[model samples]
Target: MAQAHHMRIGEVAERTGLSLRTIRYYGEVDLVVPSARSRGGYRLYTETDVDRLQLIKRMKPLGFSLDETRELLAAVDGLSADDTDEDERAALAERLDSFEAAIADRCVTLRRQLEMAEEFAERLRRRRAGRAASA
Candidate 1:
């Protein structure tokens, strides 16, 4: 069997685009605990751990709270487990569906906000151009 690759905290941060402090806080919050420790007691992470951090980073822009991110991660983990029974899998699927719906709604709202901001910026540009023309 191939051995799993491991990385230290700094590499994980660079790969996941998360700050060192944020990664440590996620560990403290039980969001993405390291997969192992080095002989010197430094935190060691696997590729899977980096993936989880990336997921959390994506959730941040969508206004997901820590609790919500945790819940979603739980559902995803449950679904991915090999020993999950049919009934449990169904429940986890339902939870994932709800999260998907919420994400879609948030995306729509974000698009609307982006459109408004763009419109405002265009208006400002037009005003500036008018002033330049008059001068």
Candidate 2:
């Protein structure tokens, strides 16, 4: 609501490390719509929207499904909004906690995958170096 400068789709893509197509697709899917439209009918985004896009980018690597992402965004938005109902706060808090646990689990899995990938790379490097030394 209170951004010093609005950003266009290209700026949003550059800042978020997301492709322009992906940002537009997110809008099409109702995942994260832009806050406003320019005089030229281009999409315009606020700082808050940029932060949301970054959150989506962070989630991408964790393999969250579209439904999961939608749910997470809903929970986050509810918590962040000013007029969240008293009854809904507790449930949103629980959802945030559950998401935290899920992300922790995913981190463990990703770490293991990274270790395996590093080992595979090391093996290839060793083989290549050994071949060059013998040549």
Q: Write the per-residue lDDT of candidate 1 for residues 1-135, one digit (tens) a residue.
A: 998899999999999889999999999999999999999999999989999999999999999999999999999999999999999999999999999999999999999999999999999999999999999
> What lDDT tens digits, residue by residue, belong to model 2 across residues 55-112?
8888989999888999999999998889999789889999999999999999999999
List the pairs of residues colliding in candidate 2: none
The number of clashing residue pairs in model 1 is 0
Indicate the worst ten consecutive residues by lDDT in candidate 2.
Answer: 1-10
TM-score of each: 0.98, 0.89
**Candidate No. with top TM-score:** 1
Evaluate residue 72 in candidate 2 and report its C-alpha lDDT on the 0 to 100 scale. Answer: 96
What ranges in model 2 sit over 4 Å off? Answer: 1-4, 130-135
Q: What local lDDT does model 1 show for residue 13?
A: 90
Write down the RMSD of all candidates, one decimal each. Answer: 0.6, 1.9
